[model samples]
Target: MKIRVLIADDEQTFRETFSRVLMEEGFEVTEACDGLQAIDAIRKDPYDVVILDIQMPGADGIKVLRETMSLRPDTRVIMVTAFGTVEMAVEAIKLGASEYVMKPIIFDDVILKIQQQWRYRQLQQENTELKTQLDGQFNIDSIIGEAQSMKHVFETIYKVSGTKSNVLVTGESGTGKEMVARAIHTTSPASSSRFIAINCGAIPEGLIESELFGHLKGSFTGAHVDKKGLFQAAENGTLFLDEIGHMPLSCQVKLLRAVEEREIWPVGSTQPIEINLRLIAATNKRLLEEIKEERFREDLYYRLNVVGIHLPPLRERREDIPKLIHFFMTKYNSEMGKECVHINEDAMQVLINYEWRGNIRELQNVIERAIIFAEGDTIKVSDIGIFNAAAIKNDNDEYDLHNAMRNYERQYIIHVLDKCDGNKSLAAKSLGVGLSSLYRKIDELEINGNRKVTNLA
Candidate 1:
């Protein structure tokens, strides 16, 4: 779109010449004979830049500028003034005019100022639109679960997202604590700014404090330049601290002060910088235990725990496993250009029954691995690969004898059926069982006939 320009001047010759010049320069120029017409034009249309002559017959430039600001503070206005009224023009600028142009106006300077203001307005609009799109994408439903526990988490996120309260998320590793933090930020009032994430455990102990509170140039060895910390970086947005329990006690004191005072004192700087950001912290380890062990500060724990959101481990929400599997299968199929569209009931059963020691992260990894190794359109028990030691070790005390035997029987039937090219009669013959018995077993195991089998011959 062409940049829109509005020229409001009492001098007919100057107004027409300016309009024609801007038009020749490819701007969409509109003219107003006086200040009243200028206000009317502003009320009726949106202009990227408005020019008003300070002295007019019907109404003056100062009156128009004030009214324009009251009506549309964002509309960039340039004041045109004579040498005698330069002070008045300066006052006009203080009242929100973009800049004052001395008469007789220099065309090139006016064009440059208009272009600058126009570009700024364009960038502001684009940024606002991008923020809206991002906020829409980071909704609670994006978490992808329907279990009661997840439903509760969604509800908590929804309620807490609209406020300025700090949030502390607790769950085992890979339980989507960071994801929950993003969801809260996306739905919050400050969604337009930024969402800065830092892992407390990932940063080295020597630099963690500086990383959170920023550092002045030459504050410490190898500090080649000044740096903005996560708090300042997340201005008007959210700062997500992952693995917060891993933060050292020394850093915790500074963090606690920052949280309490809503300001930060950078390293090697006496002046404190005030911060306006929402803090969301997450940790897999129990912070209460850390506090008791004297590894974490008790006051910081209470400060961060204003609104706690606990994400349940995947094993505890087994009911959502199938849904998650389907979600991932569809996702990977599109991403990898594979046609592995189905998961056999037995494979899904194993996924549900097995303990997910690493939680949802482990489950997603398993699915991606299975997709890589899957040979057919369907995912079979054999495609799931061998269970990891963590899973088997965790299942040792919880395994039921009957279910274990049934799982083994299902795997054996699947193996024979795949070997027989999905032919139940031939599979039965190879296994030394009657054809009717094989059919009955297939029905009992709930195995589908959609498996793409290899011909044994």
Candidate 2:
């Protein structure tokens, strides 16, 4: 990442000289003549380092430093003073000045100091990323969900991942079954290793065996070079076979043998190679019915289904619709560089009430497409086609039993909070909630980002 620095000094000579020296060190520098100017710069763009003069008009370096620290503590501030008073500089340091620089700063020394600060910032960022990943124990429990049917699905993944047994994740097409596999691998002891995924249904049957197992040189028509299969590549890791229901019966036997023996035989190779892998498979079809109809193997099905995790369709998780919409809006806003913030109440109601037959995946695609075409800062009713007035009213008027009436307004508020990425104050203001009550209500609603369901070592 580039080093972004802000230089705030009243001395034109000092600002020009310091700016040139820092730029020579390959930092992106923004210059400000006073504390007020510095604050304006900070407000406009995020900076990694701020070199502030101790004395300035409108706002002093101390106030700018304090405000900057509160807004973005990650930013480092280096105090610069022409007439260095040791006591004043010491107080500034205590107030959050990263370090103090005196007048007549050597150009060489200037580069060295900025480089050190930049390195320190990088190390801190890396530590934070690692810590977040480490402390996050992924599990279905962590997903922000509140539907009874979805709750049962999450519980199933939990029970299954705890055991070393095989898991068969059954769900309709577009349901997040692959995510379930990832949660399992991340929580398991094999987390540090690779999590290799393959779509058994998508791979051609002729190439399926070689793809799962290794292939020696000259083993087949295109076998000019030897290659390690996904199983070996994911040694001691996870191998998620998606659409296992579509796997050929012949291929199923080889997969079954590989799972049972914990080894594999390369194509046209006699020797079998041992593998340390965990198996998690997913399918959209009922294997038992397929087995009864002689389209699937009962023995294979039994082996794969030691523990079953059946993800209910999206329509079943109606409570999560508002959550998903806001999540997608945030995603689109960041990607499209749009300042788009909240979703309209009336428009959100359209999404909640719609029958999402295609499930979460479809909903995500719809939201992405809608946001890309959105015209305003806040997502308007007309931006997405879901809020068509006539169609929306018809659906509302036709439903005889409005008994399952949704808390549309409440849901919208919760969704906005999530969209702000869990920033309580920002979420509160966006949702029109008072700062003091926002957190209270978030806890009341139990609306925290759910940690992904994963296995623990």
Candidate 3:
């Protein structure tokens, strides 16, 4: 689309000249006689850039620029038609004008700046569109759980979506850490740019640096051609460093610099290239402990841990199992050409009773397998190959009716109560129950004095 521009100037001759020049340059220009008219036009519709005159009858350029900048922060503003003073230039820029041109109008420089600003605006618009589309495509149903633990995770993603702050997502393996990372980047301001994920634990130690930061041609053995690494690919976007805890100490130093300085040194390149990337890192290990144990750097830890999110294991939130089972059942049922619509009561009991050691990933895998094994209309316990006995044998987690339900409730209440620091009010609010109901249930379960429950409280 052509750039939409609102030309705001007091001089009739200058406005005509400016509109003619911009038209020739392929901009869709809208003329406004003064700052007042410009603001009115912007309020009525969208314009990519607004050119303002410093001295207008009703509103001066500085005042107009401030209003426009606040009202439409993404709009680029350029000052035109002379009235060039150091103070005017300073004020325009402070009010978010992209460029200021003197009145005698070197039309070429003005046009060049407008084009540059328009290109930047186009990139921003594209980014915004992509984010909206991707978010719709990737629904929350993609990740399971409505329990307090899962709600906390979603809340974190929502709160931090607009920033470039480095986020450290800590969870056990298969706890959907990467899914969370993807959601953060998709929801973040940089969603349109790129989302590059690298598993530090998967790459070899010797080539890991090049894999992350790129290398020039002939920089090292087998470096046949110049290459762009993940960081370069993710410029102006988000880079998800998965399994970051496994990164070797040697590579950690360079990673730290890239993250902190927003610059990268390609192998064999003397000059360091700057980058603009949001970092969302994930790990299954406790990085602070890793730092104290000398397995990771303390400085890097602090940088990446500006935001930390802890994801609970699946077994801890078994209430989400029914929802998750149906979600995957629909997904795989459609994919595998099967029509298994419901899990029998016996199968649900088996699932809820099992100690899912591998978390959600393992549950998904088991469900997929059982769907294939189940021969009847409904999924049965026999088809699942998972039960209390299996949970004990494989995961070493013993449970009966009371103990199983207690463990489930303990984890659920503790998870929500952790969010509000054991505040009964907040926990009750989160659970969608009365404060008295939550308190009575806590007492009934005898969790009031339990160490974990008390600590959470």
Candidate 4:
């Protein structure tokens, strides 16, 4: 879209010429002869940029600026002034004018200023869009689960997101501890601020303190420059420490002090810096056991565990498996540009009955892989790559002979198609079946003829 500009001045010649030049430059231009005309034009419609003279008849530029600010605060307003009224332009800036230009108007400089304001507006709009996407991405409703345990977890998140209390999340690996932390931060009072996360277990034992508390130049070997720690970086926001159980006991002492005192002393600095941030710590390990074994400090444990949240492993919430599978299927379908829309009964049974040792992360990976290799819109048992024959047994302690044979037949047809390089005629010839029979079987087996099957053998 062309940038819309409004030129407001008492000089008719200047207004006409300026509007003509802007229109020639591919801008949508509007002319106003004075402050009253400018106010009337602004009330009728919104403009991207407005150029107003500091002095005008009927009403002054200051009155027009005030009305513009009230009517359309987003419009970029530039004040045009002479040497005698430069002070008025300064006052206009304080009242929200974006910029001021000196007259004997240099049209090129004004155009440059308008372009700069336009780019700034574009950047502001992009930032707003990105923030909206992030907010929606981390909203609690985005977390997929309908199990009673998960509902309890959601309730806790809503209850604690409004407070500044420290939170300790306990769960097994791949149980989505960090996701819960983000949901809390995104909905909290400090949602506009940063959310910094560091994995305590991933950093080396010797450098964990420096990573948390920052350091001055020459504080230690290879400390070439000043560094801001995670706590300070997340000031007025949230700091998530993952795998907190792996933090060395030596560093835990200073962390306790910082948490209790709300201040931190950099490695080489004598003075302490006051910090204000919400701390969320997550760990897969059982911290109470670590404390009992003297690997973790008891005092620090109590301080960080002001409010506790425990996420159950995927196996414990078996009822949510189908929901998670569907969510992941939709997610991967969009990302990978595929049309996988359904999981066959046998495949769904196997997915629900399988032991997901790696929890939701594992389940998501399996679904993504299935979507990648699925030959049709429906994902059948053969498309699932991570299960054995025993997984297909029925709940009544009996094997499902019919499903087992159908799975075998599907795999056999896929194997033949793979060998024939997906040539249906050749595969039918090799299998001693007519070409029409092959097509019929393909349709009945829910195979997509437009795509080649990926060999799982």
Candidate 5:
């Protein structure tokens, strides 16, 4: 779709020329001769980018800017001012003008500023939509478990949702760690604000610090603009740091300071920005073990662990399996337009007895796959693939229990490895196993080259 742009200026000649230039660039341009006309036009229709001349006739640029901001805070506005009225342009910016262009406006410069503002607005809209989806997608009821362990988790979440305390969520991979974090944020007083999540293990080591704390223009080799970090972007909201045990130790010192001081110093800036937000960190690894091994900071651990919420593995809560299966079946049936609802008793038994090393997430995937493959109205043992033979044992055929377990183990490891994009260390961490142990399992399961590894180092 063409970007909608509104140009508000008292000067007709300049406005006409700018409108022609922008129209040539494929934007839908609307011209307003005065601030009152601009305000009326804005109220009548929606525009992605608004350019307001500082010396408009009826209401003036500042007044129009204020009105536009009040009406639609998401609208991107740029101020146009004469060389002598640079101060007025700065004032407009302070009042929420996205940017300012000097009068005798060079067409190229105006176009560039408008495009930048348009891109920024697009980003903001996408982020807002994502937050809406997150809030709607996960709730206390969406968690789907009647197990005692989950009930305790729900109770803890209820207690903590009203406070501004930091949270530490510990669980194995596929255990819905981030889902719990989103649930807390969605129910908290700051539910109206952003919930930014970053995986510490996924981002590169060199860029991790800047990504969290932001950077000034020219702060580093590729830092071209002043950028707000995840911490600042999550203002008055919550920042969920997933796989926090993978955070670099160098960054941990600064993180500890940010937690204690409630402020952050950008990568190259001398000044510190005061941050007001809740921090929620998640990890599958034993942080205390990391501390003992000198890989994690003890002080930082204590700071983030102010309110601990531990999620039990699916195997420990075996009774919840049937409930979770029903939930997943209902969810997938609606999503995929499938009617494969009922699970045969044999298939149910197989699922209930199986150790879900990948937790809820793995089970969800299995159900989804089964639904896609099922030919009958009800899901059968064959549709589940892994449980086909085990679920319906033959009298003459040997069970080969060790081989069956090994096959399931191999498949689970590969699933996790794929999820992590072949990052073995992260896969291992998510699997709640030591790096060395993961390597041994990979070797024992003979998953060497068939399952690719992204980084051996």
Candidate 6:
């Protein structure tokens, strides 16, 4: 879309010439004779840039600027003034005029100012979009679970989000401990600020102190410049420490002091830096066990565990499998640009009965892979690749060879069909079978009939 411009001035020659120049430069231009006409034009339509003269009949530029601010505050208004009334132009800026241009207005300079304002507006729009995406991703609604355990977790998050106490989240590796921490931060009073996270296990023991508490110039071998720590970076927001059990015993002492005193002493800095931020820590290791083994400090554990939240593994909450599957399917469908709408009944049953030792993270990966390989709107048992003999055992715990062979045949036929893009003739050619036989097998195996097939010469 072309940039829309409105030129309001008492001089007809100046207004006509400016409008023509802007139009020639690929802008959509409108003209107003005076301040009253400018206000009327603004009320009728919104413009990307407005150029108004300070002195005009019927009304002044200041009144027009106020009206524009009240009606369309986003419109970038540039006040045009002569040498005598430059002070009034300055006053106009305080009243919300975006810029002021001295008369005889150099059209190129005015265009440059308009371009700068346009760029600013574009940046504002991009920032708004990014913030919206972040809010949608981390909000409570984005966390999918309907089980009682998950409901309890949500309740705890809501209760503790309003407080300033430190939170300790305990769970298995893939149970989404970090996700819950983000939900807490997103809903907390400090949501408008940052959320800084660091993995204690990933950082080297020698550098963990400097990484958390910062370092002054020449404090260490590589400390050539002043560095800010996670605590200071997360001021007024949230600092999430993942795998806190891996923090060294020496660093834990300083961390305890920082948490208790609400301050940190940077390396080589004598003065302590006062900090205020909510602390959330997560760990898969049992801190109580670590404490018994003398690896984790008991006092520090208690301090960080003022509020506790535990996420159950996927196997423990089998009832939520269907919801989680559907959620993941929708997410991957949009991301991968596929039309997978649902998981077939047999596929869902296998997923629910199987042991998800890796928890939600593993489930998410499986679903993403299934969506990518699935040939139709419906996800089939073969698409998920869970048809092993051990998984398809009889009630008596015996391997069912007959059922296993049937499943293998089904999976192979689907694979061939997918490779052929649902072209049954080509699939039969690839499988060394007649088209009629392939159709009969498809019927016998109960393959999805809705799969789109294209015929090519």
Error of 1 at 295 (Å): 1.2
Show pairs that collide, candidate 1: none
Model 6, range 254-369, lDDT digits (tens) per residue? 99999999999999999999999999999999999999999999999999999999999988898988888888888898898888886655577667876777899988998999
- lDDT against the true structure, per candidate, is 0.85, 0.76, 0.80, 0.87, 0.86, 0.88
Backbone clash total, candidate 1 = 0
Task: Please report how far candidate 6 places residue 364 from its true position, in Å.
Answer: 1.3
In terms of lDDT, model 1 sits at 0.85
lDDT of 1 by residue, 123-146 (tens): 888987887666655666668888
lDDT of 5 by residue, 1-457 (tens): 9999999988889889989999999999999999999999999998999998888678999999999999999999988888788998898889999888776778998788888889999999999898667667877778877888999999999999999999999999989899999999989999888889999999999998899999999989989999989999999999999999999999899999999999999999999999999999999999999999999999999999999999999988888888888888888888999877777554565678676789999899989998898765666445676643333322343477776666667656765664565689998999999999998998987875243211101
Better of 2 and 6 by TM-score: 6
Model 3 TM-score on a 0 to 1 scale: 0.58
lDDT of 3 by residue, 1-457 (tens): 8889898888999889879988988989999898788889888888888888888888878888888887899999887645546578777787688877786788888788888898999898998898676676454446777999999989888888888888999999888998888888777778778888898999999989998899999999899999998998999998889999999999999998988888999989998999988888999998889888999999999999998999998888888888878877877788899977766553565577677778888888988997898675556555676543345322343545666566556545644654455578987998999999888878876654233200100
> What TM-score fits each model?
0.67, 0.58, 0.58, 0.82, 0.60, 0.83
Backbone clash count, each prediction separately: 0, 14, 2, 0, 0, 0
- Candidate 1 ranges with C-alpha deviation above 4 Å: 1-137, 386-403, 415-457
For 1-457, candidate 2 gives per-residue lDDT tens digits of: 6789999988899789878877776889899998888898998888988888888988988899998988888888888766756577788889877898887777677677877887898899999898566436244433555688777766776666566678888888877787778788777777777778899889988999999997999999999999889999998778888888889988989988988888899988999999887889999998889998988888888888888888888767778888777777777778888856666554565677777767888888878877786665555445565533222323444563342223333345445644664467887787676987876665664544331211110
Better of 5 and 6 by TM-score: 6
Given candidate 2, what's the lDDT at residue 419?
A: 60
Q: Sort the candidates on TM-score, descending order.
A: 6, 4, 1, 5, 3, 2
